[model samples]
Target chain A: MSEDKLLEVKNLRISFPTTRDRIEVVKGISFDLGREKLGIVGESGSGKSLTGRSILKLIRAPGQVTADKLSFKNIDLLAQNEKQMRNIRGTKISMIMQDPKFSLNPVMTIGAQISESLNAHNKLSKSEVNQRVIDMLNDVKINDPERVVKLYPHEVSGGMGQRIMIAMMLIPQPDLLIADEPTSSLDVSVQAQVLNVIDDLISKKGMGLILISHDLVLTSRYCDRILVMKSGEIVEECKASELANAKHPYTRGLLAAIPSLNETRDELPTLNRLQKEPI
Target chain B: MNAIELNELDIFYGDTQITDNISFDIKQGESFALVGESGSGKSTILKAIMGLAPKWNGSIKVNNVARSHGIDYDFAAQCQMVFQDPYGSLHPRKTVDATLSEPLTIHRISDQNERIEQVMQSVGLDLSFRFRYPHQLSGGQRQRVVIARALILEPKILLLDEPTSALDVSVQAEILNLFKKLRKERGLTYLMVTHNLPVVSFLCDRLAVIKAGKLVEVTGVEQLRQGNFKHAYTQELYAASGGVIS
Candidate 1:
């Protein structure tokens, strides 16, 4: 627990109970984050998204989460009760889900839904909350925040919907943000646009980010440090600049597997499962 | 003769036009791609070719045979489509064998027994997975089954609608390799619609950049590799994808 360290996770293990056995998906991985971007990269069933969800204590029963030490700013997250966790969720740690079309409320207007997030944590007058909502929308680079506020979630496009999700998540001004596959659902062009907005906002607020993605190149581009996860373990951790020259066999295999912009290979090399040594 | 041809094509979903007058042709054994953002009517164009979009004006010829507005059985045997999401596209209740066999049965093709086994192997699926339902298979495996169904007909052309978008990157590489192998072996024509430019560069010979139902530019993958796109929107799209040619 130092001042620069914004979040600390040690021996964090998440598992599920089956009919005959208990399966550990996240096998005691540890990492520390300052007010900087840290990316977790892995494929499906690799426990990347589970790691993000476990931080907010979002895992329900039958599904289990265990850790030796999970703390945020000298606050013990594992020790918090349900009510105490709620208090820390929005104001301290907010997450942007993979899809905005589902995360947003269909019945409520965009303004009402975003204002609800702010109203839940802060006691503000109606006019003050409305102004803050408009300002937040503008912060995410949404055009015509005035008209957009009046529309429903379905009315806006996917990229705009995701920005609205970002506005709602950051409106509370959390100390940490966990975006799980945030742009995977978006098109390539819109993906960069959304990531740029997040990068801008994170730097301005000086908040820590845990970006979870399956794509190696994307994580390397956005994050200061990249952690390659496989099964339930951290196979390799390195600076984003050094990802291309990474030493781990699995990491090298992943780097090689990504099709380059000017690809000339007759066949892209595929990752061999046997190369993934057991943890 | 062209494998597929569209001249002055206009598609509408009940009075609201989805795609404007569009024209493109894929040569025999050629790999062509349609690149665009979602809701830009790229998939709609595929649907119109597959006869899924019925209210299309203008001629669509497959192997020089003109297509009618309704479902064409003869056209189905000549061309096949592989959809984006494998989970949603396949029948949840049907076994892999049943799904693959239905197409052969529909075409009244003989040697059903060997055709099923041959296609499964060509797509790199193990024999053990032939009896499993869609839920029992992984995303990559299910997509292989979808591609197997497309190939089982021995069709000259395949319409792939964002085939590997749902899978992980490594799985995507495997599938892309599969596509290359199939194309090389069968000498098949591919009309793939994808938003990933790098994938388009790797798999397609020529690509059509579509924006808001209008064709922007049709250029070769060579221009894409050099990052020298002529059109402004195509340049913007390439810029978004990180224009690193080296």
Candidate 2:
């Protein structure tokens, strides 16, 4: 691993055991992340989300994840026991999902759910935990944190629920964050706000971020580097600004897939999948 | 006469007001779009026109005919809707044939066999997919079936709510092309609701940007052609949705 690198993954392969055979979703792939935002872009079954999940050992029994090297800040994640993994789960590494409704506990109040992370990680008193929850909620730009904290997950809107999820994930002060389609469910207007909040925290904490999304333009905007994946393989890797100038046909195909607002073309360009996308 | 005219419409969900004082007029054979954030009442406006939201105040006139707040049978054949999620919008248990035939049966159209064949051909669905259930089909195929179901009635006006958002980009292009061809061939009028401005640029002649349940800006397709929008909200939204073309 390099001196500045936060996470180093090498020869990482994840598979699911089915009745017939073991299907490999993520082929042996390697990548390095520094204290900067990295994006993984691909189609729905492209294994981008699975890669993110595998880093945290989030993949369950039927799915087996193996890597020659999977380390976070010099800690071997694969070697860690269950109890040790729990300690590292949210405190050192946090993840935010696509939809908040499914991730959030319906029975718990927003404040309790957020403060629960703080309680598990640190020996903070009741008042201190309350203050931390309130502050984190406000940090995400949620108005009226006091009232919002008392409300259940069902009581809030999708955007607000997502903000609460962000707050809960960030409260532990993780050194690394992996967000898988975090704002895919959000409306366009609210998407910027949610991303802005997450970006601001990443900057402030200098935490490494892996933003996994199907949206090429969005990931380019928020991330420092991008990894475009196709069929369980990294097709292209480039700096965020250089994405427009990417040389690979797959990258260009992805860029051309976006319908331009200028309305020059009668139809948006489609990827010629018949011709194999250049590796 | 314009294809659709909503006069100071107020839509409600039980006691809660979804949209207030919404009014618009779409010209015949025109493809108009309602672009807004989630819960901005864009879909509600479509629902109001479809009579799904019966608790709506004000007049909805379609092709010079006023619509009542209930199941208007004659209005049914004149307008149809295609929803966002092809997976959810389609019936899992029903075959493609049954799904397409249900609307015709409801309207008591005797020539079901011919209409079904015509509609499927219009949407470019393969004949082999006629007997398959929704679960057996791909996302794009399911969407095509949904489109076929709507066109089965041979409606003049089609209300499309985020039709391609749920499908892949390549599939989206295919479906979009189908929509364009259908409009030209059928002389169809479209009122689409979507957050994607680029889709609007491709498919719509005009666009109305909604915010907080109110119409904020209505711009020509030429404005999109120029890649310049006057309203700050519209520009902001354009930038947020990947800053495509703009």
Q: Which is the leading candidate under TM-score?
A: 1
Weakest lDDT window of 10 consecutive positions for candidate 2 chain A = A270-279
Give the lDDT of residue A197 in candidate 1: 98
Per-residue lDDT for B70-176 in model 2, tens only? 76789989999999999999878999999999998998899999888888777877677789898887788889899999888789999999999887666777788
Which candidate should be chosen as best, given lDDT against the real structure? 1
Give the TM-score (vs. native) of candidate 2.
0.94
- Which candidate tops DockQ? 1
lDDT of 1 by residue, A165-238 (tens): 99999999999999999999899999999999999999999999999999889889999999999999999999
Q: What are the per-model DockQ values?
A: 0.59, 0.49
* Model 1 per-residue lDDT at A172: 94
Model 2, residue B84: what's the lDDT?
95
Segments of candidate 2 deviating more than 4 angstroms = A272-279, B110-118, B242-246
iRMSD for every model: 3.5, 4.4
lDDT of 2 by residue, A151-262 (tens): 9999999999999999999999999999999998888778888999999999998899999998888898899999998878888999999999999987888788777666
